[model samples]
Target: MIVFFFWLSIFIIVYTYAGYPALLYLLGKACRKTKEYEDYEPSITLLIAAYNEEDFIRRKLDNSLNLDYPSEKLQILVVADGSTDKTAEIVQTYESRHVELCFQPQRQGKLAAIDRAMAFARGDIVLFSDANNIYEPGTLKSLVVPFSDPTVGGVSGAKHIIKDENTLGESEGLYWKYESFIKKQETRLGSCSGVSGEIFAIRRALYEPAPRHIINDDFYLAMRLLRRGYRIVYVPQARSFERTSYSKKDEIIRRKRINAGRYQALRYFRQIFPLKYPRLMWQVISHKVFRLLLPFAMIVAFLTNGLALVPGLSKGEPSILRLTFPFNWIIFSIQSLFYLLSVIGNISAGKQGKLVYLPTFLVNSNIASFQGFLQFIKGNETALWEKVKRADNGEQINA
Candidate 1:
């Protein structure tokens, strides 16, 4: 039973991180590339939800105004609900640029802000954006092209973490690159399971006001479209850039909140099961569900492997190396070394190369996920989210 559990845990970790992506790669090769997108220009409302984002709102409005899309066709709306700072004031200044501001005095959370703003949105497509998302000139054009296909219900653009001198920035940039690849592959396979909240668009008519408790609004919104039998694809060319989290600690806070919301969102996706939608079910389970179970699997693998190495020691074994020779010597050694490096990397906060960053990031992320699970169980997370600080005070680098 010990050996069985050890192997099962190892399998879960491997399949979640590696095997699933490999399988997607192989299956995606058989799927033909979609070339149905055209020079499509549908009326779009660029909705920016701002909550005390005074640091980023001005630049974000400027960026939005400079987009290559026709000004007449695009309606720039900034929803500053419960913002006590100069966010609403700054947005008001943009009124001369034909930018609209919808300010609600009470802080009802992001979903509520979006819901209220949607009522005044005068576009066929609603593009959800964050204050920190700096768009390239052609991003808007690329984003809507996929909508030319009637089946495509929503489209998510790629998010690039601007690489900085810090190791965290580099690792985060690499992580997003990996995610972008997976989204591309998933899009080719048919539908992407989720989207980046920073940049995604859905038909305005399909917008539904979710319950006040829906914490992971982006995933819930995207999946709701899928549940309605519409396809959501990844648009790699529609790129927006933002800096990394202010620090490792901030990253963990952000990740924990996201993961907690993901756990809470499981109930919303209950109907998208294997029997009704086999391919989608496989994708969601492999891509999203397995991640939620990973920390537990890691704990099981570590404990089981450690226990397997204890028998010889109980028999008064002399050398530490000789204790587990017949049992889990190799696996135990690898785990031990990996964790040692993780400890060192954590202390140093990833000052080293990919060798350290890989383990540091992997361990920290899993810990955050576990913390998020606990938060979800305890109902500690709320719909109103506090913003995580970004590196360099959320300044936009030239994309």
Candidate 2:
């Protein structure tokens, strides 16, 4: 038990901090930097899915209209899925003025809306954007530059989490910065396991209509491209900004939904075994599969450590075991403290205050992962969208 505890703790730490980053660094070192191009313009369609986003639809249209691409080369499509608000109306207000609005009165999920929008897209490349996120002026130019490589089928932009004075925002921003770094490395190696849904582009020829029930269309679409022997490159210079969850509770709901998607993807794509898909195997296993299992690993580590400390487990070396007990206790104490901080973070977030709560955010993410597993097992996981409340300002974060 003692041996198991020691190794498990080491594994958790290494996997989370050391192993992931090291793999990314090595991959980044191996990847050839994308080359510059002077005449790389490609006709592009920008697809945005809006669900009751009346407040932000006009801004989104304004942002699209101001993109640095040629007007004749750019086409913008907005799909308002069962939006009861003025979202569809607001988008239609910009019709023939560089925007087109597609409305479905009956409520369907995001994937369905995207599918309907894709049928009408005429561009060689289709870029997906969310209603709430705003792209930088030249983001489109940089996003498309990567596709100049024939091997590249899809491209994703860096997600910048807008930082706020609130603790929830700070923690979320920090977490995403770390994630973006990892993605950069993964792209260098070959392809990232997933792409941010907020800002990503795919060749229309390589586009596959996501299933109506698919929860994470961006990840699924990226993986499909990989399966077809195409690379998904990450463009760090291209950026999209959006607000973090308004509070810890909102963050939890959003994360749990995403975790549920992770579980679903794992089940759906089990055919990409380690031996068969060796190159991408590590990326998927480490980034998605192992992450889903981490909460259980934490539990096992704690229980095994506790069992090792009990009497009769270490019969011959009572003194040695006793001396090590404090170390085990210290580790367990830290784990508990992290949980406490998470609770504090959640409470503080409800009151809209900053608490420098990294430990809390980490614990909360794992807890949500565990809950997502339960939801998946119970068959309660649905692809239906659940919108999380966001910060009022609609700023972008670098998390």
Candidate 3:
């Protein structure tokens, strides 16, 4: 029984991160076909929900105004709800440029703000964005091209993190790159379940309002469309760039909020059972559900692995089975080393090596996931979240 648990835990961890992606890669290659798209210039409403975003609001508006899309067809809407700063003032200044502003004195969270602003949206497609996301000039053009295919109900763009020798930045950038690869494979296999909130667009007509309590609005919105038999295409060419959180603490807060939202989203996605929606169910279970459950599996693997090393720990085991002790020691040692590296990386704060970054990120993120689960249980996390400070200190450079 001890050995059974240890191996089961190990398989859960390995299969979540590695085996699932490997399966997707092989399946992607088998079902690969040239994706067909055309010049699709649908009327788009660029919706940016901001709260006390004085620092980046101007830059974001400027970037939006100068995008490659036709200004006549594109409507840039800024919703500054619960903003007590110059965020509203700055957005108001852009009124002459035909930039729409939706402001409310009370802070009711992002979902609420979008709900209020949705009444003013007049575009065929609505592209959601963050105040910090700086897109390439051609991003708008690329993002809309997929809508040319009626089957493509939504389009999610790629996110590139701008790193500047910051350890957290490096880890985040690497994480996004890995996510991009998986998203590409998932899209090739039919559709992608994940969508970066920083850059994603869906038809305004297909948009069913998600619950106001929803935390990960982007994922919830995308999955809603997917549930309706619509495909969500990931367009790598439509890239948005942003810097990492100002510090590890900030990133932890952001990740905890996100993971908590993932937990919250599970109840809403209950219809995606294996029998009803096999491929979608497998993707969600492998890509999202298993990843959320990994930290617990790690805990089980560690505890069971340790107990397996002790003599006669498994009550019914015969003395002859003691030969397995050596293998247990090896596995235990590897786990210990990983935890030790995480400790070392945390102690050496700003180091920029893969040895430090990978272990620290893996451990810290898993711990955050555990914490997030607790938050979800406590019902402490809400749609209204604190803004995470970014490493970019007011630089206006385009990526």
lDDT of 3 by residue, 314-335 (tens): 4443432342656777778999
List per-prediction Cα lDDT, in the order shown.
Answer: 0.86, 0.79, 0.87
lDDT for model 3 comes to 0.87
Highest TM-score scorer: 3
Each model's total of backbone clashes: 0, 8, 0
Better of 1 and 3 by lDDT: 3
Best model per lDDT = 3
Candidate 2 whole-model C-alpha lDDT, 0 to 1: 0.79
Q: Rank the candidates by lDDT, best first.
A: 3, 1, 2
Q: What lDDT tens digits, residue by residue, belong to model 2 across residues 333-390?
A: 7666756766776566343333438877888888899988888888887777888777
Candidate 1 regions exceeding 4 Å error are 271-275, 312-327, 393-396
Candidate 2 TM-score, true structure as reference: 0.91
Superposed Cα RMSD, model 3? 2.2
Model 3: weakest 10-residue lDDT segment is 314-323
Better of 1 and 2 by TM-score: 1
TM-score of 1: 0.94
Least accurate stretch of 10 residues (summed lDDT) in model 1?
313-322
**TM-score on alpha carbons, each prediction:** 0.94, 0.91, 0.96
